[model samples]
Target: MDWSKTKTIFILAFLILDIYLAMEFFELQDKSDYAIIQEATIEERLAAEGIEYPDDLPDDINNSFYITAKSKDFTIEEVAKLKDQTIELPNVNFEEDQSFRTLNMILDKPFPLPDVNTESKITQFLNDNIISGELYHYWYTDEEMNSIICIQSYNSRTIFQSKDDHIGMVVLHLNEDNEIISYEQSMLEQIKEVEEKEAAITALKAIEALYNKNYLSSNSQVVKIEYGYYTHSPLSNQQILAPTWHLTVEKEDEESEDFYVNALEGDVLQLTE
Candidate 1:
């Protein structure tokens, strides 16, 4: 046997192995950088302080959307009855709109609301005036110096994410004086359990879907991802709450835009004003 030749062969084999391992290491590092960037996003608003990040995230991030066809349905009467048991607002002018069978209430004059408000005050107001309030969870508050908007959602138990889940079918609007200037509500008669509780598209996949479709720019960062229900036709008597993924993307300019994707299916649900 040629000892020198065998030693040279072994050296060459080890060099190839080292190159392969180095390539794998760089790939893993790239993935780690992506995950770190994703986790660094500051969550300005949250339903809960400590939210568990999804464990099933992929090592490589790309633009792909998972889709499914599962959904639950309810009847018009059931929805109407949900509103029938609502509590009337005191000292407020209220009118029921024919479309979506929603109640639109307005104050005769603008009342004062505090710059800062408490959840209990908001919940008490809803508990006092909305029968469907018990079913909804307090989601978030959008406040200007003079006004605050408290958002609530129905069926918080099934919420998979915190982003927009609580903005279900009802929204409460208030002024700086803590006065309820107006409120808008839409109620679903029932929330029936379907066989499956799983979502086909992971939160990361939904963001990828947006990025692939050019709905999100590379410079934008995702601030929040939540599980919720979104209504496309608010005026329709037969309104359906599509299980949705609400992704709030913050741009380089510090402005944010909300992209709502269907949780079951991968379609982006757009809200019409």
Candidate 2:
């Protein structure tokens, strides 16, 4: 029999098996590395590169993504571009706190006495202006008061005015997705029928009081407000389709009127006025 030839064949078979096992081990190691990267939170990944999340993020973000914080869809090559770049997740903690406080204030009680009349004014204004949309109540805590009322022009825009003339009013536009698209500050116009000036003053004073008491200043202010028409793209490059507004605010300083001023930096944007 050809014993030597058989022995040579056996040796080749053993060598091939060893090579295959080694290749398998290396492949598994590569997979493990990929898994570790994929499972990491965006914050963790960003922190590795010394980046911090934006302050607007709510605290609850530690456990969840904000409504607008979903990951952008990226191709494999596009994502690969981020391999060495740190990506910061939207800060969710601050946002959660803001949302909690805002929701609590509005849902806690009915509209204030003065606000009832203001609501009527708002309704009439909408009707007269031929603005088509549903109106709802939105409440939030401002610098001076525990609750501030805003008229949500459903599937449209929301308007929050100060009873006083100081702070003015903010108009926030929402997209079909109910996400903020843009916001703007408008001075109360002298309307013969509505007399919104007084109402705006009151709302403003309430907010100012809240601010003085709590040292609440603007965290982010909408600098430029722009609206996306149905004919235009609602979503930004990030694929966020909510109405968009640019905001600019002072991160530091409580006393400076310039501090935390809305729409000052030309960055924070919102819907058109």
Error of 1 at 80 (Å): 17
* Candidate 1 residue lDDT tens string, 1-273: 999999999999999999999999999999999888766542321112232234443233122222122222322344355432333344544354223344555645544444465666666666756545675545555555333334444445223222233223456666655677666564445444443455457677677667657766545667777765565544233334566677777776777777787767788854322
- Number of the predicted model whose lDDT against the real structure is largest: 1
- Name the lDDT of candidate 2: 0.30
Candidate 2's C-alpha runs over 4 A off are 54-273
| TM, every model | 0.52, 0.28
Candidate 2, 64-107: lDDT as tens digits: 11112121222233323322222222454643333110110011
Worst 10 residues of 2 by lDDT: 100-109
Q: In model 1, which runs have C-alpha deviations exceeding 4 angstroms?
A: 1-100, 105-117, 137-152, 157-176, 193-198, 270-273
lDDT for every model? 0.53, 0.30
Candidate 1 TM-score, true structure as reference: 0.52
Alpha-carbon RMSD, candidate 2: 23.1
Model 1, residue 238: distance off in Å is 1.7
